[model samples]
Target: MTEHTSIRIRVTGHVQGVGFRAWTQARAEELGLWGWVRNVADGSVEAWVSGPAGAVADLVEALGHGPAAARVAAVETGPADAASDAAGAGFRILR
Candidate 1:
């Protein structure tokens, strides 16, 4: 049976202020994933995702290329706590 999985992705390189977070929000919604994307002061983008394993994998692959303006260097994904309340239904952009 398919199971729900939570993923935390830290994207390195030029991924801030270039609509990367917004793009991720849209992408996650398109794949019916629940998550939140945010920009960090360290010039990276972080996201907490929860959904079907396949969809989460797709999201991570997309994040590596991000928006046209974003120069994504790397993407790291891992298991997240099941009880973590990091995001609500539908993808949102965090401050």
Candidate 2:
């Protein structure tokens, strides 16, 4: 079986108010990853994604070049604790 991995990422730049969360959700879902994306107070986007390591990595790469409206400056990624529940089964945009 393919090993799954989780990652927490913080994307900075023109990420908020530019459909970053929704765009991220769509991208994650397309990759069959489960996790959530939200706007941070500091004008950044944060997300926790878990799935096949390759898929998660792909998502991270996409975050760097978000929707055309977004001007992603940086994407920081780190390991995240895996959840037992079906946390990665669906992607969501959190407020």
Per-model TM values vs. the true structure: 0.90, 0.92
- Candidate 2 TM-score over all chains jointly: 0.92
Per-residue accuracy of model 1 over 1-95 as CA lDDT, tens digit each: 87778978899998887888888999999998997888888888888899888999999999989999999888987777667555447888989
Consecutive 10-residue window with the lowest summed lDDT within model 1: 79-88
Number of the top TM-score candidate = 2
Which pairs of residues clash in candidate 1, taking residues 3 or more apart in a chain or in different chains? none
The residue-by-residue lDDT of candidate 2 on 1-95, one tens digit each, is: 98888888999999898888989999999999998889999999989888998999899999999999999999999877566336646888888
Which pairs in model 2 have colliding backbones?
A: 34-88
Lowest-sum lDDT 10-residue window in model 2:
80-89
> Stretches of candidate 2 above 4 Å error?
83-85
TM-score of 1: 0.90
The Cα local distance difference test for each model comes to 0.86, 0.88
